[model samples]
Target: MSANSKVVDINKNREELITFTEEEVETIKRTVASDANTDELKMFLHVAKSYGLDPFNKEIFFWKVKGKPTIMTSRDGYLKIADRHPQYDGLVSDVVRKNDSFKRKSDGIEHEYGTERGDIVGAYALVYRKDRSYPVYVFAPFEEYRADTKVWYKYPSAMILKVAESMALKRSFSVSGLVSREEMDVQQLEEDKESPTKRFKKQKEKEDYIDVKDNAQDDSLSQREKEIKRIVGKSPKLKNDLLNYLEHAKKENDIGEEEKMSINKLDDQQFTQLKSILQTFKRLA
Candidate 1:
C-alpha cells in the first residue's frame, strides 16, 4: 500500500476501536466537556481514544479554565496506563512527616515514621520497571502542591502522595497530555486574572502540563447544588459580591430576574449556571 493509504487504514482502525457509544459521547459532552467548544471536544476525544481512556468511568475528564480546555486524569488512571505497559512491575509511595526518618540512598528511598509523626512535610513515589535496574523515583514537597482548597485541607497527605505518584508514573511510563487532580490549584487560577490561554501558557512554561480545576463535576446534580450553595453560604463576602454583581448585570439587562433568586431556591441547572456566572463576574472584576 502507498503511504497515504497506510495512514488512512491506521486511522480507520483506530476509529473502529473506539468503544464509547453515541449516548456516552453525548453524556461526556454535556457533563465532562460542558464548557468545551467543538474543536476542544475533538481534541479531547482524540486524546481520550488515543489513551484508551473511558470517560464514562472518569479515567479521564475534561475541564476548562477561562475558556481553555484542560484534560485531567486521576492517579489511578496513570497507574492504569502503567499497568498496561509490558515493562511495568509495581509501585511504592509514602508521605514523610516532620519527625519521619527519611533518607535518599543510592538504590532507593528509606522512609520511616511512627504514630506521632507530626505534620506531613513531603512525599515520594517509586515506580519499578521490569526492564530497568533501578526504579523511577519522584519527590514532591507538601508546600509545593498544597492549596487552600477543601480537598487539600481535608486530605493533605493523600493529595501530596498522589502528586508524587503521578510524577513518578508519568516519568516511568512517558504518559503525556494529562494532568492529575493533585497538580491543580483552582484558587490560584481564580486569583490570577490573566487571560485563560495566557495563564495556562505560563503554567505550561513552568510545569509543561495542562492545569485543571477542582473535581466539582464528579458530584451528582443534587450534590453539586448543595455544594455550590454551601460554598456561597460560607463566604459572606462572596455572597454579597455575587448579589451585587447580579444586580449590576440585571441593570444592564445581561441577566434576568430568575438569575437573582436566592441560591437556596435555584434548581440544579440554575445553580450550575449561577456558579458559572459568578466565576465570570469575578474574572471581570
Candidate 2:
C-alpha cells in the first residue's frame, strides 16, 4: 500500500482525550495558595495527563534555560510587604532574614539595608511578555547569594494570608514586567542593529547548509550505478552478475546468505591483491 494510505489507517486508530474541567481549574488556584509539596500538586499532573496543558511547565523551562529568576528576585525582594499591609511584608521579611543569610550592599552613594539571604517567597506576577500569562515572582533577602549552597526560605502561611487580605483590600498594585537577565539581553539585541554574534551564527549556518548540499549532490547515485562504481576493476559482465544476484537475494528475503558470500569474496587473498593494485591506480588518478 501507498505511504499516505498507511498514515490514514494509523491516524484512525489513535484516540483523543479531554483535559480538565472549569471546576478543576478553580481547585488548582486554591491549592497553589498553600505550601503544597511536589506530590501535593496532583491537580496539575491530572491536567497535564488529560490535556497536556501545564502552567508551571513554562516557568520551569525558563528557569532551566536562563538559570533562575534573577530580575524578579532583585526588584520584589526590596518591596516592603509591611508598608502595603500592616506588618505583612515585615513578617515575611523577618522570617526570611532569620532562616537565611543576608548581606547589605551600597546603592551607589547610599547604603540600602535589605535582607540578602534566606528562604525566598514567590507569588504569581503579571506576565511580562505579550502573551497574557502569570509568572512566579520570587522575593528573597538578597540576589548575590550563591545558588548552589544558599538555603532559600519561604514566608509563613499566616503572612501569605495577610498579604492576600491586603490584595483583596486594594487591587491597585498590578503585576508588571518582570523579565530575566537573558530575556532582557535578547530584547535589547532586537531593539538594536543585528548583533555580531547573531550575524556570525547566521553566516556559519548558511555556509554549513551549502557544504551539506554540495556533499549530498556529490554522494547521490542510483543503486545500479553504485554497484557498477564499487566493482570498477571487475569485468562489466561480473558487475552485472553481482547486481542480479543482489536483486534476487532481496526479492527472496535471502540477503543474509548473499551478504556472507560477498564479505568472504572481498576478504579473499586474491581480492586484497587486486585492491592494492586499484589503490595505486587511485593515487595516479
In terms of TM-score, the best-performing candidate is 1
Q: Write the per-residue lDDT of candidate 1 for residues 35-61, one digit (tens) a residue.
A: 578778777877777677777665777
Error of 2 at 217 (Å): 19
Q: Worst ten-residue run, lDDT, model 1? A: 206-215
lDDT accuracy of residue 276 in candidate 2: 33
Candidate 1 TM-score versus the reference: 0.65
Using lDDT as the measure, the top candidate is 1
TM, every model: 0.65, 0.15
RMSD of each: 10.6, 25.3
Error of 2 at 53 (Å): 16
Give the per-residue lDDT of model 2 (tens digit) for 144-221: 221211111222332333232223222223323233222232333444356779856854543432211211232675
- Give the Cα error of residue 121 in candidate 1, in Å: 1.5
